[model samples]
Target: MHISEGVLSPPVLITGAAITLVGTWIGLKNTKAQQVPLMAVLTSTFFVASLIHVPLGPSSVHLVLNGLVGILLGFGAFPSILIALLLQALFFQFGGIIVLGANTANMALPAVIVYLLFKKLCISEKRRNRIIGGFLSGSISIILSGTMVALCLFFTGSNFNHAAKTVLIAHVPIMIIEGIITALVVDFIFRVKPEMLLGTEH
Candidate 1:
């Protein structure tokens, strides 16, 4: 679901860049020294997860684990996504530098939104609720990201039919896998390192 450079208009790309910069700044401001190690690990996990692609019809989908990142990192999701995407672009060529802002914003915004929704679930104190919230957050993150990508394509005057269909269909299986994985990971973290999540003031 990575949007390569030259696919979007300059105006759209500039807007995305501006927004991503602001988001990154906010995320950096919220990041704490103690969370650096966890952020590094989670960012690495996000990067590696993208490599495990599942073929779906004419397209391929990959697990993002963005929801789990959001749950664990809170507002720090912005920088986590920015760093992960940058690494992917530089090392894997998953996306281009010119389109980094749009791609990062597309993926990261959903994670941030999922974090907000999960926060509202009032599951901060309950184990089962946290697991369920993590699953739901992960599932919704893919859906939101896919939809945003479709909209971006449409706004850029691309033929939305094929792109939309491909994204929607390809994401279904990945979404399910992400939800299950996120739940399991969240549960594990809750058992072993609940403080990582609970420590987030947001």
Candidate 2:
């Protein structure tokens, strides 16, 4: 779901950069010193997971894992995702440097939102509830990210309406795939390493 460079207007790009900077600052400030290692691991996980793309009609989709990051990291997901995106842009050119902030914000904001909404369920003792939380968090994150991407494109020009729709539609399977993967991962972590989740208080 990376938006290439030069596709967005200057205002949108500038606004995105400013918002991401503030968000990353807040994320870093709130993240516990003890959680830095976990954050780094999750950042690498996101960076690698998104590299394996599945071909779609003309475009392709990849595993974002943003939902899992959000569930575990909360607002801290912003900085973690930003770092991964930066590497992807610099090393693989998966996305452009110009749109880095917009892409980071678009993906990370939903993660934070889902984390807040589903944090309780994710940490619940019941397996069923945690599973539901993971599925919803994973699925909704992709949906929201796709919508955010479309909205960004919408602001650029009316010609992008069809492209926006296509992007959203192509990600339907990704939503499901991410949902299942997130549920499995969350369940495993809860059982084997509950402290890894946000609000666990070590």
Candidate 3:
């Protein structure tokens, strides 16, 4: 979800910027030379996926293949998503510059969470477990990101309560669609390129 500029308070803005700076640094540090190209590809995927967004209240709804990015890149999702968001803001003004950090944190933090929670299951020996993990990773990451967006609005002001609820409710359908999409992609990767997923590279 892209939170518009001038919506969040100053404190929230600072907090988000801090989180993104540290996260992006760590992500860059963790990234290997060989993985740079893959990182670039995933960054573009995120950039394109989010370009087609439907406005929902103050924020917007769109496909965020963050689960795929996270499970594939781990901490690398931070830089990958950060770059995508930066480009979107620079070119399309999707989220604006001031609120860039908040938007990135809103979207990319869930990516890191999914990587930690579902990476092992996604890289599991059993096909069924991998599918389940993929589905959950995709679905839960959306839910988590949506909720974070709602909270940001709510924290900004009580007037956004309605918009916050709408944002969360709107994400339910996206979560399912993304879950199915991610499940299929993860299954294919397992068969054709299992090493592409996190924790399975070794």
> What TM-score fits each model?
0.87, 0.92, 0.91
Give me candidate 2's TM-score against the actual structure: 0.92
Local lDDT at 62 for model 2 = 76
lDDT tens per residue, model 2, 137-182: 9999989998989888888898999999998897788898888888
lDDT of 1: 0.80
Best by lDDT: 2
Q: Which of the two, 2 or 3, has more TM-score?
A: 2
Report the C-alpha lDDT of model 3 over 50-162, residue by residue, as the tens digit.
Answer: 76675555776677888888888888888888889889888987888989888888878998999999988998889999899999999999999999899999998999999
- Superposing all C-alpha atoms, what RMSD in Å does each candidate have to the true structure? 3.0, 2.3, 3.4
The candidate that wins on TM-score is 2
Query: On residues 55-160, what C-alpha lDDT tens digit does candidate 1 reach at each position?
Result: 6567776778888777777778889999999988888787799899988888888888888888545245677787788788888898888887877777777666
Please give the CA lDDT of all the candidate structures.
Answer: 0.80, 0.88, 0.86
Error of 2 at 192 (Å): 0.8
Off by over 4 Å in 2: 53-61, 198-202
